[model samples]
Target: MELNILAVGDVVSPAGVKYLRTMLRKLKQQYCVDFCVVNGENAAMVGLTPSHADEILDAGADVITLGNHTWNCRDIVPMMEDCPYLLRPANFPPQQPGRGWGIFETKAGPVAVVNLIGRCDMAFGPDNPFLLMEKLLPQLDTKLILVDFHAEATSEKLAMGYHLDGRVSAVWGTHTHVPTADCQILPQGTGYITDLGMTGPARSILGVLPEQSVAGFRGELTSRFKAAPGPCKLEGAVFTIDTATGRCVHAEGVRIHEN
Candidate 1:
């Protein structure tokens, strides 16, 4: 038996969340996805709120993963501890609210979803994801494990894919907000991709207004980053895993843009 898992990229602002609300169900149906995981740390352009989390959950995500911006929104602080479907990076301090991994029941059996953050260009201090993964793997009882490695550096993401190649069903990168073309099944059977991209304005810079991003880079202290307007797009990837063996047999990146 095969199970199709859809891993959506980080959502940027309300625009991204709106796109998910409108298209995620149809997209899941189009791919025959059995389980869905969405990276939603950017639902508010900084961090998502409880309302944003609820909308994503209603948008058909079985599990919602977060990254460095996980604690940016004060409104979501309590929800992080109360919502089992919401996950922060596993490598975050143990005292932090919420969990980094969870096991959910699915028709294919129990599926485990792990959220991890990287230490690349990100200045935030968190435990080393690689070492944390190795320590956490033995604790997960299920073979159908899916991981969302929210990292900025492509090399780091690729290294993580290779690191857990045969151990997990699929490992995909998030936070880059640019879909990668390197979707493939690793030699050891894990489905891998450098990044799944972002679900928000397609023409913006990582879902923020391009002009604003340019200004900030130009040494101008631009106002707080805001979501770009106009057409929205949803980007993600689909991994077809063989349930019996807990290995990915096929992997493909997907995108949906509003006209």
Candidate 2:
């Protein structure tokens, strides 16, 4: 009784959407993926219209997770209420734009997928994930729980993973966009990864052209970041978890590059 959960990295623009379809279209059968999740905080950087979010949903993602940039596109706020599948950081103030969790019906049963933000250098939200998760875990009727820990600090992500290891089925980190070397099943049975690599132009720096990001770093001039175009790369992981044991049966990193 194992279920495949494909978690994709940050999807930034139209090109990114195409990459997702191209790379993940074969995954349903190839990976036996029963559920697919993606982070879409960067969707509108190339200027996300509401159409951008819809495109991701229509492309193949079952649940679209987001981060601090969730509110970047103001128009997408209304989409949140209608599309509960789209989730922003749960720790965001209660007045935030999107939901924190979604109930997914899988072959095993219903699974709870939570989108959480770390309170380090990132957004200073009112709710605490450590405290909030303890309360939220009990309320969920399903044992198969997955969390997307989007944070800037490595300490935050790693600490959270240790904290929730036995409680959830898997804890996948995002936001940095660089895949970490650490990936394993925790003592408590939860599958864990420090960060799932991003899906975008791999040659670029975390989805943006290196030159552009470097310019900003140098503080020479402010430049609007754009998704690096051309051949793409998809980065993330697929975790198969047992419903009865609430443990990961298998966990593997997925990296596909399109030339």
Q: Best TM-score goes to which candidate?
A: 1
Across 1-259, the per-residue lDDT of candidate 2 in tens digits comes to: 8888999888766777777877676865689899999898776653345787787888788999988787767788788878888888788888766689988887889989999988888645547888999888888888899999988888888899889988889999998889888878878788988899887787888888788899888987765787776788888888999989778878888888887
Worst 10 residues of 1 by lDDT: 69-78
Which residue ranges in model 2 land beyond 4 Å of their true spot? 46-48
Clashes of each: 0, 1
lDDT per residue for candidate 1 within 1-259, as digits (tens), equals 9999999999998989999999999999999999999999899999989999999999999999999999889879899999999999999999999999999999989999999999999988889999999899999998899999999899999999999999999999998898999999999999999999999999899998999999999999899888889999999999999999999999999998999
Error of 1 at 219 (Å): 1.6
- Backbone clash tally (model 2): 1
TM-score of 2: 0.95
Q: Estimate each model's TM-score.
A: 0.99, 0.95
> Residue 207 in model 1: shift from native, Å?
0.8
How does residue 140 of candidate 1 score in lDDT?
A: 92
RMSD of 2: 1.5
